[model samples]
Structure formats: C-alpha cells, structure tokens
Target chain A: MLPAAALLLVFLTYPLGLGVWLGFTDARIGRPGIFIGIENYEYLWSDAVFWLSVFNTLLYTISASILKFALGLWLALILNQNLPFKSFFRAIVLLPWVVPTVLSAIAFWWIYDSQFSILSWALQQMGLIDHRINFLGDPENARASVIAANVWRGIPFVAITLLAGLQTIPQSLYEAATLDGASRWQLFRYVTLPLLTPIIAITMTFSVLFTFTDFQLIYVLTRGGPVNATHLMATLSFQRGISGGQLGEGAAIAVAMIPFLLAAILFSYFGLQRRKWQQGGGD
Target chain B: MASVAIDEVYKSFGAVEILHGVSVNIEDGEFVTLVGPSGCGKSTLLRMIAGLEKISRGQIAIGERVVNNVAPKERDVAMVFQNYALYPHMTVAENMAFSLMLKGVSKPESDAGVRRAAEILGLVPLLARYPRQLSGGQRQRVAMGRAIVRDPAVFLFDEPLSNLDAKLRVQMRAEIKELHQRLKTTTVYVTHDQIEAMTMADKIVVMHDGIVEQIGPPLELYDRPNNLFVASFIGSPAMNLLRGEIATGGSPSFRGAGGISVPLASALSIPNGEPVVLGIRPEHLRLSDDQGIPVIVAVVEPTGSEVQLIGRTAGGEEIVANFRERHSFTPGETIRLTAEPSLIHLFHGETGQRFQTRTDQ
Candidate 1:
C-alpha cells in the first residue's frame, strides 16, 4: 500500500498538481515566471483557434464514438455465433487493438497517403473517381479521415468487451424466449438489449473518453493539420504548451478539458449505471 | 392438452449419435417422465419434443399435427428450464406476461393472465419483484407461472428442480405434480432422479444409452424391470445383483462363487448350467435362523424407519439389506440372509434380458 501510494503521488498527483500550477503562471520554455492568475484562461476564452479545436474535439468524439459503437456491436454479435474458426476470428478482430497505437497510426498514414492509397487505387481502377482523393488536405475530409482511423483503432476494444458481455448471458434464456414465441428481433429487443445495457454503458463511456482525448492518429495523419480542422483537445494542448513554448498557455488549455471529461464520467455514472435491476442482491 | 407421439426418433450431433430409435406414445393429459443418467439423451429428447433440437430422423406428432418441421411457438409447448431462465431485468408479472405480449394480447387481457397465474403460483405479492430478488423456490414458482400463463397444449420440464436444495426439491416436486393434476395438460418431464420420476409421472420412460429400456407405470417398472439397466436404475438403494449359474438337477438352485447357493423357483425352465444374474431388492432380504446364504456384516446404517445393512457374501460379493425392525449387529459378525424364492429376479448372463418365471404371470 505504501509503495503504491507513493508511486501515485509521485507519478500522477505531482504531475497533475504541477500542470494546474503552471496554468496560473506566465511560464515559458527554460524560464520560470511569476503568477498571472486566469490571464492565460481569459486569453483562451477569446482565442478563435481554441474554440475551433473545441468544436473539432466534440465532432470527432461524437462521430467516432457512435461509429465505433455501431460497428463494434455488430461485430460482437457476429463473433458470438457458432461460426467456424470462432476463436481465430475473435483474435483477428483484436489485431488493431493489440498493435501499438503509433504503429497502427503509421499504417493508417500509408492507407491515407495522397498518391499511393490502396483505396484510391481501387476506386481509380474501377473508374469511380477521375483524380486522387485529397485525404489529409481538405478540412472536412481530414476530420473524417482522422475519425475513421480512431474508430478503427478503438473498435477492437469495444467489440471484445461486448462479446464477453454477450457470452455471459445464458443460452437457456434464449431457448426459453423461443418457446415463449419471440421472433428473432423480439428476442434481441427484449432479451439481448436489456441484458447488455450495463456493459454497453461502460464500454461506450470508455470509448467516448478515448475518442475525446485522441491525439496519436491525428498527429500521425495530419498533425491536426489542414487549418487545424482535426485538432482534438489533447493535440491542441500539446501544440500550444510544448511545441509553441508557451508552457502556461498549454497547461491552461489542457486544464480546460477537465470539465467536459468530468461531464462524460458523470453522465455515465448517473444516467446509465444506476439501473433499478442492477441495484439488488445476488441471484 | 394434446397427445404426443414420438416414433423412432433419433438425434445426432455431427458424427456422434446421441439418441437412436426412441419411441413413446403419450396419451392426452398424461404426465410422462423421461428418466436416465446424465448424458443419456433424456434432456435432448425433451428438447426435440419442444422443437429446440432438429429431429435427425423419424417423426414427432403433437396432437394431430406432424410437428417435425413446426417451430417451437407453433408447437404450442412451454418449457421450464433447469435454471428457471427467468429474465433478470423483468419483474415477475412482466416475465409471466411476456409471451402474451408477444402474441399481441391486449394490455388488460395480458394483465389478467399474469394476475391469474400469479395467484395460482402464490406469486401475487412477488409480482413487482425482479427474479434476482427472489429465493430459489420463489424463482422456480415464477418460472412455472411463466409457463402456466401461456396455457399451451403441452408443458416440458427439463430437470427444473435439480438446482434447488433437497428440501426445496421435494417441495417443488409436489407443487409441480399438483400443478399438473390441476391443469391436466399433456406434460413430458425429464429427470435423472428416479424418485422424481416415480412420484410425479403417470408413466415412466426409462432410457439408457440413448434407447428406451422400459416404458410402464411407476410400480410396474419398480416391481419388474425389463433389463439389468432398468433394474439397477429404478430402485433407490438399487437391487443387489449376484453373478451365478442355474443348476437344474434335482430342485433348481443358483450356485454363486465361494460355495454360496440360493434356491430358485422350481418352475423355472432355463437350460442347465446356464450363467445368469440373480437380483433381489434390499428390503426383500430377511435374517435366517439356520440355513441361508452366509454373509459377513460390513456396515450398518439405521434411519428412524428402517435399518440398512451392508454385508459381503462368502464370495466377496457386496449385498445390501434393509429391515424395518431395529436389529443391532457388530461389523464383523457373520449372518445368514435369505429372500423368498418368488421375489428373485434372474437375467441371462450374455443377453442381460430378464428370464420369465411362473410368478411373472
């Protein structure tokens, strides 16, 4: 306990405290500065780039999380069936997650390359498009592209977790429902969905958090580029705080994201976790 | 209520055949139990009746309809699973009414159905509670209520009481039997427990190795089993089977190992020196004063109603005997035990089929 507590204090709390402290001062690279309370935050409140990044962050998180959930749940249901080579397919579905994020991001970089992308090549061969797609050049296209990559990397986590939840449901319930005259869709609506809600809530909360703070895929693919259209809160904070040498301003930007993260956590806790059936004694 | 006729049905999973050529004719409003050991295809047979498993060959008819291709819901059967399988998310009332709701029954009608079932099952107070909040017996009642509310043509129970404690199992067994009597629905139940099969079923279908060994009334099977399997499986303490051969010279007698001999019915006409197995129930054995098969007492267990004694014969064959009168004996004491000649069962050694004697008539 002592060792774990000391490690948390030194690694987690100390860095977090330092970042919060830095947010209040006018500190720069290689220079300690005096306190300038709320100045950096006030400046960020009026900054247009900061606002654009906030919008980008919301759009990226919402769209990516939604896409990840839908595709992940579909994959989970399919994998739950008595398919041939089921374990092999399940393990294959987890490849994107098992690979390092930076490695997958690099792979996606090549997939989205302007001239050599296989997707563009296939489309061109099929006479679907006349010219190459500017995947990372246009703002909207860049945002969508980065979100796609994030969804790809994040789907394995959701799919595997949801597949585990699906397996926990007893097969006897399905047989009972069939005898009760439930059509396939009715079984899903009444039996599968209700039982899977708690797991969905937890998995989606984690997915949303991961998408909201996503930085690696965007950095590798665009560097929040094409007029900063794909700049998430995380990348923008790093860009302003570390790369731009305005340590205090970057810390302030990073600190500003806490309220939204806290909101996500609170929403999942109050809105999703407190189910009536879940609040009971053991069966 | 409906009659179920299963004719020469078979079930195979891949290349592994589970049930082979099984048949039973269930009368309308009859309670039939399929009893066997685990992995003997009793549950699989019940599932095939419920249309949960595809019949590999042959036909199963429910009522007047050949239901081999019919869907489970269309077969008009409701099943109570071993685990109860109550929806954990729904309250008792909702669980009972789910089938009615799926059938597009109106709100008031569905509610009335649930209410009636709740009352019958004594689940009226628990109607608002979830399945997890109920005790095992209460959950079992809710499962039965769910089946009862449907009021289907047939009820299939797949070892529904196996999960409960011994006391709860007995109580539920009686409740299920009473429910069957009150409803008078054509019911087919599956259980590995012979006692459950005996107490609840109007007719018992004893299965072993995926084939129907015997089908008869409870007492018929208890008094006379068709083969060695049914003889050993039906009785509680199980019949004591001794390997021996029939000696036809003079008065017929059974000569077992270690110079042990017992009298056979004089009217028996099996060939001389034909190897056979002799079977007798534990309760049929009585203490002999002078001439009897010699046995050394190994263990004695006295319940309030009877004294159960386990002993070894001179041939080292273990034998069990139950006596209503309380008699004390030391473990190493040698005693002579005997059974009435008419109460004996003889089976041919190679075939395992019971031999007919004059008393069987």
Candidate 2:
C-alpha cells in the first residue's frame, strides 16, 4: 500500500500539481516566465480556436463513444454465441485494441491519403464518382474520419470488457428466460441489457474519457487539420505547449479537461455501487 | 395439470449417447421421480421432457401434442434448477412474474399470479427482496414460486434439493412432496437419492447406465425387484447379497457360501445345485439362537431407533444386518442371524435377474 501510494504520488499527484502550477505561470518552450494568474485562462476564454477545440472534443467523444458502444456490443453478442472457432475469433477481435493507436492511425492516414487513397481509387474504378474524394482535406470529412478512426480503435476495448461481463451471467438465466416465453429481442432487452448495464456504463465511461482527451490518433491522422475542425483539447494542448511555444496556455487547456473526466469516473463509480446494492449488499 | 409421455426417447451428444430408448408414462397429477446414481441419464431425460434438450429420436407428448420439436416455452413445462437460477437483478416479485409478463398478462394479473405463488411458497414476506438476500431454503422456495406462477403443465426438478444441507434437504423434500399434493401437477423430478424417490414419487423410475432398469411404486421396487441392480439400488443400508446354491435334496434350502442353509420357499420347483444369489434387507435379518448363519461382528452403529451391525460370515463374506434388539457384541464376537423365508430374494447367478420363486407359500 505504501509503495502504491508513493508511486501514485510521484507519477500522478506530483505531475498534476506541476501542470496546475505551470498553467498559472507565463511559461514558454525554453524559459520560465513570471507568474501570470488567470492570464492563460482569460485568453483561452475568448480564443475562438480554443472554444472550437472544446466543441470538437465534445463532438468526437460523444459520437465516437456511441458508435464504439453500438458496434462493440454487436461484436460482443456475436462472440458470445456458440460458434465454431470461438477462441480464435475472440483473439482476432481483440487485435485492434491491443495494437498501438498511433500505428493504426498511421495506417488510417495512408488509407485516407488525398491523392492515392485506396478508398477513392476503389470508388473511382467503380464509376460511382468522377473526382477523387478528399477524405481529410475538407473540415467535416476530417472530423468524420478522425471520429471513425477513434471508434474503430476503441471498439475492441469495449467489446472485450463487455464480453467478459456477458460471460459472468449464468446460462441458466437465459434458459429461465427462454422457458419464461421471452422472444429473442425481448430476452435481449429485458435480460441481457439490464444485466449488462453496469459493465456498459464502465466501459463507455472509459471510452468517453479517453476519446475526449485523445491525442495520438488525431496527431497522426489530421494534426487538428482542415482549419482546426478536429482539434481535441488534448491535441490542441500539445500543439500550443510543445510545438507552438505557449506552455502556460497548453497546460491550462490540458488542466481544463479534469472536470469532464471526473464526471465520467463518478458516473461509473455510482453505477457500480448501484449494481452492488442491487446484488443484495454486504449481507 | 396435463399428463406427460416420454416414449422411447434418446439423447446423444456427438457420438456418445447419454439416454438410450427410455420410455415412461406419467399420469395426470402424478408425481414421478427418476432416481439413479450420477451419470444415470435421469436429469437428461427430465430436460428432454422439459424441451431443454432435443430428443434424438422418438416422441414426447404433453397432454396430447408431441412436443419433440417444441421449444421449452411452448411445452408449458417449468423447471426448478439445482442452483435455483434466480435472476440476481430482479426483485423476488419480478423474478416470479417474469413468465406471466412475457405472456403479455396485464400488470394486475401478473402481480396477482406472483402474489398467489408467493403465498403458496411462503415467500410473501420476501416478495420485494432480491434472491441473494434470501437464505438457501428461501431461495429454494422462490425457485418453486417462479415455477408455480407459470401454472405449467408439468414441473421438472433437476436435483433441486442436492444443494441444501442434510436437515434442510429432508425439510425441503417434505415441502416439495406437499407442494405436489397441493398443486396436483404432473411432476417429473430427477434425483440421485433413492430415499427421496421412495418418499416423493408415486412411481419411481430406477435408471442405470442410461436405461430404465425398473419402474414401479416404491415399495414394489423394494419388495420385488426384478433385477439385481434394482434390488441393490433401492433402500437405505442396501440389501445384502450373498452368492449361494439351492440344495438339490428334499426340504429344499439355500446353501450359501459359508455353509449357511437358509430355508427356501416351501412350494418350490427348482433343479438341484442351481447357483443363485440370495438378497436380504438389513432390517429383515435378525438375531437367532443356535440354528442360523454364524457371523463375526465387525462393527456396530446405532442410529437411535435401530442398531446396524456390520459382520462377516464364517466364509469371510461381508454382511450387514439391522437388529431390532440391541446387543453389545464386541467387534470380533461371533453371533447367529436368520431371516424369514418370505423376506429372502433369489436371483439367477449368471443373468442377475430374479428367479421365479414358489407361489404357494
């Protein structure tokens, strides 16, 4: 316990305190400046790009989380069935989640290449379009592309976690439900959904929190491109503090994401507690 | 309640068959039990009747319809699983009303069904609580309540009392029998316990190695078992069997392995020196004076009412006897035991089938 506390203090609490301190100073890339209270936050409040990044973060987190949940639950349900080659398929389904996000985003970047994209080439050859599709050049397309990429990368995590939760439910419950005259859809709605709610809450919360502050995928794919249309708070913070030489403003932007993360974590915590209480409590 | 017919049903998984051409006719409101040791295919037969398992061949009919291809829900049968299979998320009332709600019953009707079942199972006080909050016996009643709410054509029990403790098992056993009497449902219960079958079943189907060995009322199976398996499987303390031969001369008698001559039925028509196995219940053998089989007492256990003595015959064959009159016999002390000729069971040595005894006794 002492070791864990020490590690968390050294790696987590100290860095968080340092970031907050940095946010209050006029720190630059190489040299530290005098303390400037609320200056960076005041500038960020009126900065149109910062507000746009916040909007982008919200849009990306919400859409990507929803899509990830839908697709991942579908995959989990499919995996949950009694099919041949089951373990092999489970291993294959988890590959996207296991691989590094940046590497997959690099692959996506190639797939969405403006001039030599395979998607555009396939569409062109099919005679469905006359011009090459600019997947990342347009603002809306870039936002869609990054969110889609995030969903694709996040799906396996959600699916695997939800699959584990799905397995913990006894087969007898399904048998009982079947004997209760429940149709397939009603069984899913009444039995599977309610039983899966706690895990779904947890997995989607982590998905939302991660997608909200996601950086590597956006950095590799669009780099907040198409006129800052896909700049998540994380990517914008990295660009401002590390590359744009405004460490104080970047730290401020990074620190601003705490409230949303805390909200997601708290939602998951309460969901789990409710689950415990529903399971008859400590008695 | 509807009658259930399981005719020549077979269940196979891959290349291995678990139930082989089993058939049993359950009358309406009859409580039939399938009793055997583990891996005896009793539970599988019950599952097949419940439509949980597909019958590999032959037909199963509930009331009039052949429900071989019917889904579990369409079969109108409810099962009480060994683990109770209660939904952890739902409250007790919700769990009991789940089936009625699935049938699109009105909310009031569903609540009424659940309330009636709860009242019947003594679960009225626990109606709002979850299953996990209840004790084992209460959970067991809730499982029954879930089945009771359905008003099913038949009730299937798969070793439902095996999970409870000893005293609780006996209590639940009586409760389940009483429930069957009260509801008068056509019930098919599966258990590996012979005593439960004897107590609860109107007709007990004794199965061994996937085939029905014998089907009869409990006492009939106990008194006149057709095969060696049935004779040995029924009854607590089990009937003691000894290999012997029928004496060829007049005043025919059974000359057992240890030179113990037990009086055979007076009206007998059997060849001389015919090898046979003699079966005697522990309670049937009693202490006698001089003219009886000599035994060396090995151990004595008194279960309050009756004294069970484990002894060996002069030939070193183990025999268990339950004596009504208690005696303090030391472990190696010699004693004599005898049984009435009517209490003796004779079986063919080669075939393990019961030998036809003299009728005019």
Candidate 3:
C-alpha cells in the first residue's frame, strides 16, 4: 500500500497537481511564470477557436463512441456463434487494436490522402467518383475521417470484452428460452440484451474516455487542420501549450476536460452499481 | 396435454452418432423417464423431443402432427434445464412470465399466469427475488414455475434435480412428481439416476449406448430385466451375476468355477454345457444352514430396515445379499446362502440377453 501510494503520488497526483497549478499561471515554454488567477481560462472563454475545439471534441467523442459500440457489439455477437475457424476470426478481429496507434493512424493517414488514397483509387476505378476526394482539406470530411480512424482502432477493445461477457451466459438459457417460445429476435431482445447491459456500460465508458482524450489519430491525420475545424481539446491543448508555446493556455484547456471525463466515469459507476436482481446470495 | 411419439429418431454430430434409431411412445399425461449413464444420449433424446436438437433421420410427433421441421416455439413445449437456467437478470415472476410475454399475451394475463405458477410452486414470496437469491431447491421450483406458466402440451425436464443436494434432490423429486400429478402434462424427464427413474416415472426407458434396452413399469424392469445391462443398472445394490455353464446330465444345475454348483429351475431347458449367467437380487438370497452356495463374508452393512451382506463365493465371485431379519456375521466367515429356483435368472453368457423359461409362460 505504501509503494502504491508513493507511485500514485509520484506519477499521478503530482503531475495532475502541477498541471492544475500551471493552468492558473501565465507559464511559458522554458520559464516558470507567476500565478495569474484564471487568466488563461478567462481568455479561453471568449475565444471562438477554443469553443470550436470543445464542440469538435464532443462531436468526435460522441459519434466515434456510438459507432464503436454498435459495430463492436455486432461483431461480438457474430463471433460468439459456433462458426468454423472461430478463434482464427476472433484473433483477426483484434488486428486494428493490436497495431500501434501511431502506426494505424499513419495507415489511415495514407488512406485519406487526397491524391494517392487506395479508397479514392478504388472509387475511381469503380467509376463512382470523377475526382479525388478532398478528405483532409475539407473541414467536415476531415472530422469524419479522423473519427472513422478512431472508431476502427476502438472497436476491437469493445468487441473482445463484450465477447468475453457473452461467453459467460450459459447456453442452457438459450435452450430454455427456445422451449419457452421465444423467437430469434425475442431471444436476443429479452435474454441477450438484459444480460449484456453491465458489460456494455463498462465497455462504452472506456471507449468514450479513450475517444474523448484521443490525440494520436487527429495529430497524425489532420493536426487540427481545415481552419481548426477538427481540433479536439486534446490536440488544441498540445498545439497551444507545446507548439504555440502558451503553456498556461494549453494546461487550462487540458484541465477543462476533467469535468467531462468525470461525468463519463460517474455515469458508468452508477450504471455498474449492482441492480436489485444482481444483488443476491451465492448462486 | 398431448402424446409424444419419438419414432426411429437418430442424431449424429458430424461423424459420431449419439442416438441411433431410438424410439419411445409417451402417452398423453403420462410421466416417462429416460434413464441411463452419462453419454447414453438420454439428454440428447430429451432435447430432440423439445425440438432444440434436430433429428437426423426420423419423425417426432407431438400429438398427431409430425413436428420434424417445426420450430421449437411452434412445438408448444416448456423445458426445465439441469442447471435451472433461470434468467439471472429477471425476478421470479418475470422469469415465469417471459414465455407468455414472448407469446404477446396481455400484461394482465401474463401477470395472472405468473401468479398462478408462483402459487403452484410455492414461490409467491420469491416472485420479486432473482434466481441467485433463491436456494437450490427454490431455484428448481422456479424453473418448474417457468415451465408451469407456459401450460404447454408437454413438459421436458433435463436432469432437473441432479444439481441439488442429496436431501434436496429427494425432496425435489417428490415435488416434481407431485407437480406432474397435479398438472397431468405429458412429461419426458432425463436422468442418470435409476432411483429417480424408479420413484418418479410411470414408464422407465432404460437406455444403454444410445439404444433403448428396456421400457416398462418400474416393477417390471426390476422383476424381469431384458439383458445384463438392465439387470445391473435398474436395481439399487445391483443384482449379483455368477457366470457358469448349465450341466444337464443329472439335474439341471449351473456349474461355476471352483466346483460350485447351484440348481437351476427344472422348467428351464437349454443345450448341455451351454455357458450362461445366473442373476439373483440381493433380497432374494436367504441364509441357509445346510445345502447352499458357500460364501465368505466380506462387508456387512445394516441400514436399520435391512442387513446388506457382501460376500464372495468359493469361486471368487462377489455376492450381495439383503436380509430383512438381521443377523450378525463377521468378515472372512463362511456363510451358506440360497434362493428359490423361481427367483433365479439365466442369460446367455455371450449375448447378455435373458432366456425365457417354461415357468415364464
């Protein structure tokens, strides 16, 4: 316990405390600055680009998390079936997740490249497009493109975790439900959905947190490009604190994200609290 | 309620067949038990009857309609699984009502059905509780309640009491039997316990190696087993089998190893020196002082109602004898035991099939 406390104090609490303290000061790249009492946050409040980044972060996290959840749950269900080569397919599904984030982001970067993208080439070859798609050059397309990349990398986590959860449900329940006159759809709606809710809550919480703090995909693909339209708070924080050298402002932006993350955690915490039926004596 | 006719049903998984040409006729409202050892395909047959398993090459009819390709939901049956499979997330009432809900029954109707089943199973207080909250016996009752709520034509029980404790298993066994008596649904139950089959079934189908060895009332199977498997399987403290050949020279007698000879009933006529197996239930053997087969006593167990003596013959064959009147015998003591000629059973040594005698006519 002492060692764990020391590790937390050194690695987590200290860094978070320093960041929160820095957010109140007009700190610079190479020099410690005097405390300025929320000056950075006050400036960020009136800034349009900061508000735009906040909106983009929300949009990106919400859309990407939803997509990841739906597709991941669908994949988990398909993989749970008694298909041939099941383990092989399950292993293959984790490829996107296993690959390094930077590496996969780089791969997505090339896929979204305006001129030489394989997607564009295939579309052109199929006579579906007349010209190259301005994937990153267009603000809407860039946001969608980065979100798509995040979803691809995020799905395997949800799928594998959900698959593990799905396996815990006994096969006899399905047999019992079948004898109880449940149709195929009714079986899933009544049996599968209710049993899967707890896992869904946990998986989606982590997926939301990962998507909300996502930086690598955007940094590699768009770098908050197309007039800062795709700038998430994370990337914007790095841009202002490190690249733009406004350490105070960047720390403030990063600090502002805590409330949202806390909300997500609290939502999942309550969702995970044992339901009345789940609270019981030993089985 | 409806009769279930499993006519020449066979099941195979890829290359290995589990049930080979199995058939059983279940009358409407009759309680039948499929009893066997593990992997005897009794559960497989029960699942096939439930329409959960597809029959490879035969027909199963619930009532008069052949339900070979009918969906399980359309077959109108409810099953209680060995594990109870009571949906862990739902309350007892909800678990019972789930079937009616799937049938699109109205809320009030579904509630009435759940209430009725809960009352029948004595699960009224537990209707609001989850499965994990209930004891093993209670969960078992809830599983039955779920099935009872459906009011289907047939009820399928797949080793429902196997998971309970010994005392609870006996209690649940009686409860399930009583439930069947009250409901009068055509019930097909699967169990590996011969005792459960004996006590609960109207007709017990003894299965061995995926085939029906015998199907009869409990006492009939106990009194006259068709084969060595049934003889050994159907009875508790199983029948003692002594292998020997019939010697027809003087008096028809069984000549076993070590010069031990026991007289056979004169009504039986078989080829001279034909090898056969002799079967006698433990209770049929009586203590004798004079002419009888000599056995060296090994273990003595007294269960208040009866004394079970385990002894070995001079030929080194183990024999079990149950006596209603208690007598003390120490280990290694030689005791003489005998049975009436009419009580002895003879079977072909090679084929394990029982032979009919003149007295059987």
Question: Best candidate, lDDT-wise?
Answer: 1
Per-model TM-score, in order, reads 0.98, 0.97, 0.98
**Model 3 C-alpha lDDT per residue in residues B250-274, reported as the tens digit of each score:** 7799988777788988846699989
What's the distance in Å from true for residue A232, model 1? Answer: 1.5
Count clashing residue pairs per candidate: 0, 0, 0
Give the alpha carbon lDDT tens digit for every residue of A1-283 in model 2.
9999999999999999989999999899889877999999999999999999999999999899999999999999999999899999999988888889889999999999999899999999999999988999999999999998888899999999999999988888888889989889988998899989988988887888788879999999999988999899999999999999989999999998988888888888887676532665331
Off by over 4 Å in 2: A281-283, B359-361
Task: Sort the predicted structures by lDDT, highest score first.
Answer: 1, 3, 2
**DockQ of candidate 2 against the true complex:** 0.54
Local accuracy of candidate 3 as per-residue lDDT tens digits, A206-256 = 899999999999999989999999999999999999999989999999999
For model 3, what is the error of residue B106's alpha carbon versus the real structure, in angstroms, after optimal superposition?
Answer: 1.7
Better of 2 and 3 by TM-score: 3
Alpha-carbon local distance difference test for all models? 0.93, 0.90, 0.93
Superior by lDDT: candidate 2 or candidate 3: 3
Tell me the alpha-carbon RMSD of every candidate. 1.3, 1.8, 1.1
Greater DockQ among 1 and 3 belongs to: 3
lDDT of 2 by residue, B49-138 (tens): 877788999899999999988888998999999998888888889999999988989999899989988888888899988877888888
